[model samples]
Target: MREAVRKESEIFSELAEICTSPGYVHAIASLCYQNNILIYADKLTPEDMLQQFARDILVRTEVSTLIGLACKKQLNIDLPSPEVIQRYIDKTDSLLKEIHQSMMLPMEYIFDSNEVSDHNFNPFRDGLVLREPIFYSGESAYYFQYRDLSKIKYEKDNDWFLRNKGFSIQQVIDVVMSIQSLQNDKAKNVLRGLFDKNPSEWTVLSAYKFTAKEVSDISNIEIDTVRLVIESFVSSIGMDEFNSLDDFNPKNAYPIIQLPEDEYLLFQIYSLTQALYETPFFWFNDDKAYKNIANQHRGEFTENFSAERLKLVFGEERVFSNIDIYNSKDQVGEIDVLVVFADRAIILQAKSKKLTITSRKGNDNSLQSDFKKAIQEAYDQAYLCATLLNDKKYKLVDKSGKELNINREYKEIYPFCVISEHYPALSFQARQFLKFQETKNIKPPFVMDVFLLDVMTEMLQSPLHFLSYVNRRTSYGDKILSTHELTILSYHLKQNLWIDNKYAMMQIEDEICVDLDLAMLTRRDGAPGSDTPEGILTKYKGTVFDQIIRNIDKLEHSEIISLGFTLLSMSSNAIEMINNGISELIKRGRKDGQHHDLTLEISEGGLGLTIHCNDDHESISRPRLENHCELRKYTQKARSWFGICIGQKVPRLRFGVNKEYDWVQSNEMDELVQDLPKPQNLEGKNKINFAPATRQSKKVGRNEKCPCGSGKKYKKCCLKQEWRM
Candidate 1:
């Protein structure tokens, strides 16, 4: 008895618990059988069994979600949120319900070849061998197709179906049987409403006009037997039991009883036989299935397989090596991965997907150009090693100083892919393409699929897969264009139009000859012919090339011509503008035998301004094109007395001269003083030496009194000016 209890076979322990707690006992028995464990041997109670089932549901859901997250992280992909996952689960469950409804019909109706009136219809022949309904519905039905059978299809019986007035009695019986047996009556009616103009209203429409007694007589089964059969079938088809079988108490359990033992007995035999038939398919697994199985036992398989694959591929040496990563100045590019070997550097630019390239001349063909341009653009912007600054140093520059190689021709360049978890096929395909390129020795511009795949698998694990390297010069270009260059270019174009309009106006002035509006106008003899504004502007569009030309003209004509020339190197737009404007201006200036000395002055904070004069003299000049406008060049004298120094006892660093001292000693004094310094005071001074002895000085005397009238020492008081002041 002790040995028997220790073994706790299913029959003994499970049946024994039926007298105590049937529901818990049944669940325990099912779980024990599934796991090949003995529940009684472990002394599992009804409460324990129920808790275990709940725990299992939670565990499965958790494990699935965790695996999903891991895959997403590995591929650097964004996974759907928990709410989204929940929605997907709900949708899957809904679809399962629909499948179950389709599967709930009787085997006779599902596979019968006879007409509506045929008394003999066999379901077992059409692979509807299962007497229980659970084998046919929802996830279980899906499972069956994969586990018990290789395929499924409905056979057409056109002759039989046509003869039944487009309505087979068997089809009606099947639909009613499915509807009546289903616990979800709402779903049942909704399904029935889809098929006919009218449907009978009844709780369980198993038959028409026949009472339970009459139906039982015809079917050779009791009412309870019929109900039990439906319930068992539903269970077998993967429908969860809402209530335990033992809890099912029919109102008329033995009403019209017939073939009582044989019915249940036949169902049991069918269930056992089907399980036996599914054993081979359920147990067999291919590589794909093995992966699923391995994932299920992830705790054991993950670490071991990781190590094994690493050993196989990389041996003992670590695959990753460290290198310096600099913050790229260019916003449009980043360093996907950097590898430095003895004589070369490998830079990878990874993308989420590959562009589709075509050879035909069409929009799709532009993908090749786009691909080439993108890679070249990224390369152009990438930081060149400071040591490798000039092409001349590498013997790669021609005699004319042009680069001998295209930026894309560098062997170390690699463009890889960053991918989502579901795109393994694309990754694999891209890898094959890259490998093809490598083997064929295709040039740098060619897109290779193999390198792309490797990059996708290896580098995409990092969240920052979108990063690329951008060169400092191009980064500066981006800043310039976004700020000053674009605006200035546009302004130059506007100014050029203004000048052209003015020139046309002058030409029209020369052409017109009229006494008044009442008289007919005639062109003045030998006067410049006027051109219409539209005619002059007709050929021009605001294209980059046109802007370049206009900008050059503006630069040459600017009062600060040299400053405008310097702008050329600062920005590409500036360069284009300067070239066009300066070339034209220089040609015209040479013809006129005059040139403006335009120079640039840069302040401490890098603010630049242009000063222009007719010669080396530091004075402002008017340009012919600028409406002949002239403005004075004066050093802005400090308006307050605190900025100038003159005479003893004079205000310390005051802007104005002392009243008691001779005004002749300071230039500032000469400028500030009114009248001829009083005629009496000038009479004593030597007339030959009386050139108003004003001298300019940058510094003031400290011995002078405070300018603000504070009695303290000059240096200690107002002479020590506040910085903000």
Candidate 2:
């Protein structure tokens, strides 16, 4: 596989002799046309298509860009015919595909050597990219973070973008923002302008490609200026002459691709977002004269961007920026941002450092260093704040040295680390390298870039919904394997994001993001994706399940987060079964002679649930339900038991019971448990209710049959047993 990659250099070199620098970038843009990319998926499922494209010939052209930097030299020779050019493209593609296939077995052998396989099944073998070429829809704050940030610090001489890139950041932003403000573009330009001449020839790639004059007209900027700044986004890599060369930092790195016909193509919408959001990451560091001041201010900008996004997701009053923690008179540490709402809190640390290009190319030492600077250090800072927030004695103060008033001592603390820009393979690398300290009080830190934070805030605007997602996302830990954080987040928008058990590994593919992308693109006043989508959590919306979850989010108690954790962690099917049982009990009550109460066992942490259907008075029904719950909790040896009452005679949610999480395994239930009923196990690992046909209680007369179904008087039928105590 390695040798095949080596031989491909020769092919790129042969092809480069015929084209210019922009030509190489152009070839990649043309080959990845939405039409060309999806041709293979026509007959296969998305997963299968993703598999096919991962090893397809069309995807290998990007390598030629890296190996052959065409801006340094130019060929004046006439280019080959269309047939000849395609032959070279096909040859390079086949060799790259062969090399991609060859990588599977050897990588598996290496993984099996040390064997992290014991903890998880090896998914490293499928090193496939999801190729979300049309993902960004301009809702993110990519432009806000990097545009004209240094104007305040440096005045004009050392303005970061101008000093480093010889162009005003604001100018580029004007063009990008204008292009984004097109006619109802659902991630593709719906504006049928001069650029889309001859619909037959124009593929999906043409929708994003635009002429400088068109941009100038829309933005009201000078055509020459628009042309220059737009050119800054174009990669200077042209057609490569086949050769293997030493790796070096690219002098001219751009995300956009330029064509011979004078149109600029953002092959993937990510290219534009990356340009506005991440372009300054290297530029600020590379400028020798202004690097110190520029880098410091860069970090501050990242902190500010994160603080704003946090404020949007969790309201402004709850979010405090640049917080200082003090114990007594001495300062403990500083937190970039701290959010405390209700009983849920978030500790955030922002870093401007990015993964070096060498790290992306697979240098282990560089990967570790870049990961440490970009994520690990931020996590360390957030974790420090998290530990302090857990203790009541520490005071969180604002810049004025006045203590920030908190509503309550937060129980569920979610720590986060936000970066300045996109880091390739960030999620996977964190799983491979992140070493967490004690995480009992707070969850594992979720690391993401500014762009992701923008999208997350836009979609999940409500504090409760965002906090619930953060709770569930952190619970999964490294069990989630994905190339991007957005993929997992996208799944949460469509379905309840939870796995059945701890050891199971879940791979969230990028294809899952298609719906989210389209939603973001086509959203207007007419319609839009719900702030919270229709998923498993919302399946029983307004039912007892929703009532409990909503009420939990608003309540104040030290141990209340524990209950929220259980409810949020319930899988999609788990909530369905419990809610469905309520409906079935109501139907059976209409038939006259049938069981009304339900006792079901949840597979989550040995938890059990019992819904009492009868509308008997609280004086009798409440205690009877409690007694029934206690028996199930002991008999099943569950961690906790929840008892609920829904009415048939009085059809509304009346009351519920919270069996304190104090289960103790002992000989207490040995004799009494032998006769008690249990929920039957049904098909599938993710079943909510095991047995749907179990019963509960009511006020028992001395002569009436025992609630346990012993068929004897309550007084004589072992009601005085020590187990009830």
Candidate 3:
């Protein structure tokens, strides 16, 4: 990758020079027009011109076909066919005309001015002089005159630049080929150098100093040859008028092109090269020795890269690489990268084998076969590692032979196959396989998620966000438990001491049966025929058993039992709501004088309550209670029951039930109350008054029972009233 980056940087430098040169741009534009490739030659970048020329070359099949036809029609004559000769002559004449036009076109120039000058004022009148320094703004165009040079600055948009309308890639190719066809080896070499320079190194003044001996030395060409090429190039492009080499040194006349400092330039070059060549150009010319080394070590490199990326994402403490799972007798498997987040573990298997897709027929067969093999190997390795890590009996060791402190209590394990390439079709197949496994009750030790190496690196930066993303794509069976669900469950589990364990268990079993009956009945238009309650229980149990079993070892036995009860309570509440809705519908129907029969039924394959109307047997209402929105609402409500039940927080009762045998007031009771004994009159015996006592009585403790019949503490009862009396 580093080598590729370097090569592309060099290539872009060269192209940038050609792109910014006004003479080269005009010459290319004329060639493009002559070749019938450039519909509009304005604002054309070198990249665009190359793309247009390639398209033109691909489109012109008649030229090659005609040449072949001429070859076949050759007869033994002093001169070849006149028609062929005329065709050739026409092509030559067109090329010459294009060249002449390119020379005649005025060159667009860019100049930098440190000082500003107003167009309305005469600079000479104020004794002001402006110096023109050649400036390159990475564009090609015709002559441009700034109306207000004062307004221009070196900033992005304010910089002086010129360009015609953009040209297509084919036009650029045409321009290159046109330069090639000039048959001037020196000119070709010079053009190649310009094309090779970095974008930042492209400057109008520097491009003109091609005759220097230093340039010849750097380019490995003779001085005379370089000077001859420079002279020919300037004359061809009509730049002879600007030549100042006769009176001034070439080095002093033009500024040296500076090397690019922009870090983003490398990426730009990579993108441009990718656009021009189907692959990076350097890859085609890769050294065999280096290629072999790269291929051999690619796996190790990818593994390290992935490890570092995960470390950056999840913290160094949370990520481990080159983990070896082993039994006492032998090594089991190796994990490329392991990331532990909370109680969840993400095990990654990195496959660095480069797989290619060929254009030949039946090529995909081999590709698919290799892909499947790679996927199987990655999955197997990941599964083995996860299983070992999750089992207490086995042990894991790092590369340095240090035993890892493996936590065997992981609640979730995400096995991933990280590949260098993005193969959507293969990913789809992997997803389908996982879905199939889920349906078959074949819980594959871990859910395998396939990710491109680049994508995995990006996702690792925000692990929680990535997990949520995976949760949303739950169809692949790689969903992580949502934090919301975990939070609710955790809060309830912590408060398990307050839960009525026995009552919860009993209620949960009954609720499960009731919920299953109602759910199965409402699911279809009939009663569950001969299916026993036990059988229905078995079926529903299967649905939640896998989840329950996976979590069983992670919690205490009591907690697991509590969790079962909570799930049952939630399920029951959801079913009860549906049942109540159905009952309301039935009541409304009956009030309207419509005869409807509601029955709970269970079939061997089904369990649900069904409603049937006697008036219309064919048109029975089967409320679609299974709509996801309604089901989710019920599920959430049911889930909330865990918090409510464990917390011992009962909601206020909205309705009351009446019982027989209660106290009642009657006329006889009123007469009996009048005949009850009356206390002796205290007024007749309490006439004596005593002087106020100076001493207070002994204080009574607040906890002591009150003498008053209110059964309250003495301080809270009549203790205060005694002082007032």
Candidate 4:
């Protein structure tokens, strides 16, 4: 078979070249080959041999052509002629009419053939009529199937076998059926012969089967239904109409599976599972999904400080590791831990009671409020934990009058104590609070994983799938709003509808479960009065509006605006910095409260002020504050103190200083120098004197005229006028 196929390949190659030149010689040669005119090999010219070879090539190359040719021969028709094509078609129609007239005959033919087959005793293989067909072992069998013979229909006739005319559906079916019924050796011979006789019809048949039944279940159904389903399924596949069997379910006639008794849906289900299982797994580890998830599980944070402090430094690597020293010292409340070399001490508070919340009877949203309260309590506990770790003196104990001590000797000693999911909302809140504190230069030690996990769980409303969302937006980040935060926002909005929350609906498959309601309820206030779009966005904007706050610095400072707007927005603790700056200015004893008008005050060299002060009574001296003022003195000391004055009628200064500084004074007031320094000490330096020189009254000559373009007398144009003036 291999040798024959190789020879056939060579013939086809020649035929390809012959096809390029469509002359009668090549054409007739091709036609003779198409007709399978293989004469005695020793009695033929090269052209005749080539033609005979081409005929064999076309006959054996395809299954449908082989079957068609057999049909033609069975009906006793010549190849490559109009009459032969009609006869082949007629034979196919007659065969189908005969089969439909007596379906039992075909069934009996199948039964008798199977009984003689080797595996006839097996129930699964043989009891089912089409499960095991006597097919020639080949690669094409991978896609081959026992198709229902009755379903095929030709959309159009493509009969190239009988001199370019076409064969009908019945003709092709009959030919294929007859081919299938032959014995293995006889079938091969018949197929080779049919290929020689009707190459085009066989090609069409091969193409039809090629198009049908990709991944289908056909274990049960009536024969007629099977025929329709198989026909539709095959046609669908051939035409590339739908991408998957899932799409073909609704269109088929036989409920898709002809054999309905078996668990056919299981096959489709398994197929779907395989598809999902085989999907790329790059997301498991290094991908954002994994990283986001993995970071939630943290490890030891070994930095420069911890590296130097070895457990063995004090002659024992296991110092306190096996001991329960804190267990004996059951003193409750806060304890201070010395940081050795640092001046700061750490505070540890023992929280005796496990943090929990209670609902108030008057509140309609007691459950929700309690949930948030618990979360905040947890956050505070975590922050307290961080504070203890950072300073080494704080601890929390549950309500059982139990003293909980965090031992530094343990490997898993996180900055915060472990809390339950009941306080989930607190995790993110606590994290944000700690971050704010850190930004304010407060040192709070928190486990990186604790912070990430807590924040992730709260924000995502899912357990720690830390790896999943690390590189993607969490629900919190999705909209400037969180669906979980909407409940709180609803109360603020004075509306009961928390209905348009989509993030709450997300199905997150992670370990930590969160009540998304808490997330959706948290929202910022709206803008001042107007309910415009800008107003709404402004209203909802929280600390995230820091960009706009920074921009506000560009405006002239108004004390009322600073105190009422800026300070009111800032934390009370943060106002300490502003108060200290203002106090330092006040102690200098300059009055005029010019510093109160922060815009002018900043221009006058006080730290640019805003209304962020805690109290108005902190300052009383206004007139004395402006007494030391000197805006632009040109003395050596002033010049040395300020850099070169550029493009101005005022003294030099920095970006923060303006022309208004002339009205403000420094505490260090000194006398201005009147006499200029002598050149004897400043020759190499840039110092210059403005004193007049000698020989200034010399007379001008007549020809020494001005160079101006007036075109007047040399003395009158410019030089004479200068002398007279």
Q: Of the candidates shown, which would achieve the greatest TM-score relative to the real structure?
A: 2
Best prediction by lDDT = 2
Root-mean-square deviation per candidate? 33.9, 7.8, 31.0, 33.0
For TM-score, candidate 3 versus 4, the one ahead is: 3
lDDT of each structure? 0.25, 0.59, 0.34, 0.25
The clash number for model 3 is 43
Sort by TM-score, top down from the best: 2, 3, 4, 1
Candidate 2 per-residue lDDT over residues 238-267, each given as its tens digit: 433223322332322465656567766554
Better of 2 and 4 by lDDT: 2
TM-score of each: 0.16, 0.70, 0.32, 0.18
**Model 3 per-residue lDDT tens digits across residues 1-725:** 11112232243233333323322322222232334232223432323333433422311112211211222221111232334433444453443333223222122211113323544432211100101000101111000101011011111211111121132223322222222223223333444565787643432222212223444445554555443323321211122222211111111111111122310001011112112222211222254544454343445645666677677656788789988888885888888899876556778887643333230111335444555555757777777677677777777889999988856666556676765322323332343232222212112433222222333333224444343233323322323222111121212222211223233211111112222222222222133332222321233333222233223322323223332332233333333443343344344444554332222211111222222222221111111111211222222222211110000021111111111122355454343234222211112232222223222245658776443222335564445444444
> Model 1, 609: alpha-carbon shift in Å?
7.9
Candidate 4 structure lDDT: 0.25
* Displacement of the residue 37 alpha carbon in candidate 4, Å: 66
lDDT of 2: 0.59
